[model samples]
Target: MSDLNITHEFGYKNNPNSQAFIESFHSSVQREFVEYISFNDIDDVYNYYMSYIYFYNHLRPHGSLKYLTPDFVFYLFNDNFNDFISSYDFSDFFVSVKK
Candidate 1:
């Protein structure tokens, strides 16, 4: 849904974990974005958020997947991780230390 006011606007039905996760995510996002930014206007905040979102999606490593980024695993490995599974091809391409 487009509405970010998830908890207040649309209450979590049976999943309380989702609410916690969203709260945690909001805290993290604030720490990473809102806390540092000096908001002059909503447009400026939106622009900054767009850039941050790009970084989160494309650059940040996911902890669940052995700390490898989604793009790094899919696109960086040419979408075929098995191709480099034989050798240290894709594994050694980036940081050897998982994340």
Candidate 2:
């Protein structure tokens, strides 16, 4: 096995902006799927996660995306995603950062 060294950082100490989003996603995964589901094996785990991730990105309404699914927002603002993101209000999601 390969040794991988990683640092532990609590909350958003490193990057307040993006860290909040990352934390929220992790929390959602725990709450939405991990807490209640059990997998028979590795393949089952992989398959379930693949479906869940697709649903989360394409069908779920994210408040940060203005209550739009990421897929819709992505296509709607595909030309300049950064520009579209800059105009929207992220406060809806940003304010609810966990820890």
Candidate 3:
């Protein structure tokens, strides 16, 4: 689907193009984390997963986000996508990152 079309379909009122992106984020984290972590139960997994999120948001530099971490990229992408529109298409915003 076209970016604008898909954006409308999955978007919320404030950010009409946010749902798909959020879903894609969950999926990527799930694939990279959910399947990889061998936690005995939910608590252990939650603890480790929370740490991983900290790394992703505060440390990991994402190429798609202009080599910025999720913390940086979050504001960048949401503020205005015109800067990185070429590298990140709408679909990519919904696809799992390569493991």
Candidate 4:
């Protein structure tokens, strides 16, 4: 890190709350996605995770966002939020993909 001119920051020692969000995401990924997949190689892992990330952010409805997708929430808060909400029907927008 010193040679690369990068500063490594550490969370407060013994403070679990500081790492709660990262822990939660890791747990979710392990339980929901990683547990089910058998990867052949690093490329396979990378490809699978790339698709999963797209599904996670664009398709999956998160409980924390009141069942709205992260992408939807992002658009909802954008400058044209009202225009988007008025023109788009999210109820029938979802397409089911078999894993």
RMSD of each: 7.9, 10.4, 11.8, 5.9
Poorest stretch of ten by lDDT in candidate 2: 88-97
Higher-lDDT candidate among 2 and 3?
2
Greater lDDT among 1 and 4 belongs to 4
After superposition on all CA atoms, how large is the RMSD of candidate 1? 7.9
Question: Which lDDT tens digits does candidate 3 get at residues 1-99?
Answer: 585566334456786357766776787698878888799898998899899887666666666677656754665658565565555534423435697
Clash pairs (backbone) in predicted model 1: none
For residues 22-88, write the lDDT of model 1, one tens digit per residue.
Answer: 6766776889888888888999999999988876655666676577765566755575655545643
Descending-lDDT candidate ranking: 4, 2, 3, 1
What are the per-residue Cα lDDT tens digits for candidate 2 across 12-81?
Answer: 4576565777779989999998886899999999999998898788667888878877866775767877
lDDT of each: 0.67, 0.75, 0.68, 0.82
Q: Write down the lDDT that model 3 would get.
A: 0.68
- Give TM per candidate: 0.51, 0.61, 0.50, 0.69
In model 3, what are the clashing residue pairs, if there are any? none
The collision pairs in model 2 are none
Tell me the tens digit of each residue's lDDT in model 4 across 7-76: 8767788886788777777887998789989999999999999998887887788788888887789988
Q: What is the clash tally of candidate 4? A: 0
Candidate 1: worst-modelled 10 consecutive residues by lDDT: 87-96
Q: For candidate 4, report its TM-score.
A: 0.69
Task: Write the candidate numbers in order of decreasing TM-score.
Answer: 4, 2, 1, 3
Give the poorly placed runs of model 4, Cα more than 4 Å off: 1-10, 82-99
